[model samples]
Target: LLLSVPDSTTGTISVTGLNGASNPSFLGMFTTIAGFEPAGANFNNHYPMQDNVSDFHLYDIGEFFPIQPVADYNAETGIILPPNPNLSGQLKEYQIEFDGFEQVHVDVFGLVTSQNGPNIRTA
Candidate 1:
């Protein structure tokens, strides 16, 4: 599996075999805030596990709608609080899993930029 994050909000994940590795039977991805961990965080999203007509098995995060928080209301004061803050600067965690492989290898590469000029990489 190879993961690439070109920007803060968009990414592409690709899974492929090495020389003669067989195709996996399943593929899943799970994502959550880094500091704010959630329950059952593994493999929450599943993708179709089949041979693509094209040469790549890829999933794009931009194709899905962003997750939104529910509204919070104060019963006593009759006021609604604002939604959560944006994801900027906050760390995020992504987990990828698959089946039908005796062994698996994973690699991640990313380039993040901010208003200040600096490049960052994480493992």
Candidate 2:
């Protein structure tokens, strides 16, 4: 889930996934990094502050910069993607960096074995 609030200083400009979720696990995946892309023609630079996890990975203007803005809540894996300046026509979507995985349940004791896979959900 994406949560956004208008900039206190710039009311017209709202940021998505800025404040971040208080409970990192609330959305199932811990929001290691979150950023916003403004609506416009040119590609602008935005900041994705480190929230629950440190070592936040960031991509800006064809370069990658990793920083630690928050206390350590280390992520097991890092999310990656090729750089896109257009960002799929800037609708103010939150660039969410998350490790997408789910738990599996198995009935080891029963003769009839049952297996379960991860649940899939859309934003």
Candidate 3:
């Protein structure tokens, strides 16, 4: 199952496996890491505030940035790409850095087993 946040433009995606029956299990996750491109693209140069939920976790724009400690959250993983979600669905204005211009196409592969049965309307 895929959940998208159309309102807000930026956020992380959490992939949980659900069996046909409970809570979902963690599969994989991924977050944006700034400063991977141009020299001026360092996260510290543009956004100084550190948000764990933000895709970019580290930036060295000529500053002593205390990198966000990597965790088992939805923003960190080698095999997961997070979906966008926002709390306020009305005002959705978000801008982020991506390798691709405008949009980025992602591919995910995993066998999700849900604990909730099909009777439950997750949609």
Candidate 4:
């Protein structure tokens, strides 16, 4: 079961299972703000990969988010992948679940800056 599910990519994010030593190995990365996953279940080489940002964190718990946020910026765009295109059809290749669509929601968070003056923030 995932806690957060984002509709688009977070540029770069860390992926790990909810608990235990096993984590959801980074499946794929979204380069654009809006996009979709090509038809398939083999996320082995399908997920996006990226070099960790300068001290920036990608995945928190199991959700994806940017390391930093700008004032007013929003990642509200979210798309939920449905289970199977239709009823009678069993979509095994896509891994569309029949029960709870466990997913990771994406969002932006604020950060305290080092600058003495005020800093901008967004989510």
Candidate 5:
């Protein structure tokens, strides 16, 4: 999920994963920049930030600084299951809430495991 904040205020965003049989896991959130060509064309770019090792000075560009989340409740390997009386059987629901600042872009990463197999997918 890509979120673009228009104002300079603190806010919270909620992400939910609904599945009939399994609960999806919420991974870490990250900020990224859009790649652009000099001729005005846009392209995909992969610039990963290393935790505790990445230098923001080398990647910072004016107002396009990295936006970090204030509080992430699901930034771990734990499974989140919200209480819902409407759900039954193997059905499960997961919700992740995080705080963010204004005038920034964020990406919410998540992981979902396949119920039929051992394969896992990223979202």
Candidate 6:
């Protein structure tokens, strides 16, 4: 049976299974062109996992050197910041699972200037 589902560009996606099941088995794969994947994965690895600024740390210091706003930063600091110069990164994609549903989030993170450049001293 075909299930009718809404087209939500950046939100959760829910679909009904053949047996009226809400959480259907799902398999997903991600592929990227030559250098894009590494670039993205690298960015993702550096991307800040914490959403709080106070959660950032650099060698025992519980604050990002020179300090930065969470709304403007994407990666963790003091871990060999990328030399992208001008400081930049992308969202690539993300997955969220809840209430028997998995939502894939994809969007560009755009761009923001880094308070501390990749060469900025963090001591």
- What is the lDDT for 26 in model 2? 28
lDDT of 3 by residue, 71-122 (tens): 2335455554333343111111122234322333322212323456555321
Candidate 4 per-residue lDDT over residues 38-120, each given as its tens digit:
23322243222212211112322333233232223235755434443232221111111222323444332223324435864
Give the range where candidate 5 is weakest over 10 consecutive residues by summed lDDT: 55-64
Candidate lDDT values, in order: 0.34, 0.26, 0.29, 0.30, 0.35, 0.27
Q: At residue 111, what lDDT does model 5 achieve?
A: 32
Deviation (Å) of 26 in candidate 6 = 26
In what order do the candidates fall by lDDT, top score first?
A: 5, 1, 4, 3, 6, 2
lDDT of 2 by residue, 14-107 (tens): 2133333121222222233333322232222223223432222222221112322322223565544444543332111233432221211111
* Superposition error at 86 for model 2 (Å): 28
Off by over 4 Å in 6: 1-81, 88-97, 108-123
**What is the TM-score (0 to 1) of candidate 3?**
0.15
User: After superposition, which runs of candidate 4 have C-alpha atoms over 4 Å from their true positions?
Assistant: 1-12, 33-36, 40-104, 107-123
What would the C-alpha RMSD of candidate 2 be, to one decimal place? 20.6
TM-score of each: 0.21, 0.14, 0.15, 0.19, 0.22, 0.16
Q: After superposing candidate 2, which stretches have Cα over 4 Å from the reference? A: 1-53, 61-91, 100-123
Off by over 4 Å in 5: 19-123
Clashes of 1: 0
Clashing pairs in 6: none
The global Cα lDDT (0 to 1) of model 3 is 0.29
Where is the poorest 10-residue window by lDDT in model 6?
53-62
Each prediction's Cα RMSD? Answer: 16.6, 20.6, 19.8, 19.7, 16.1, 18.6
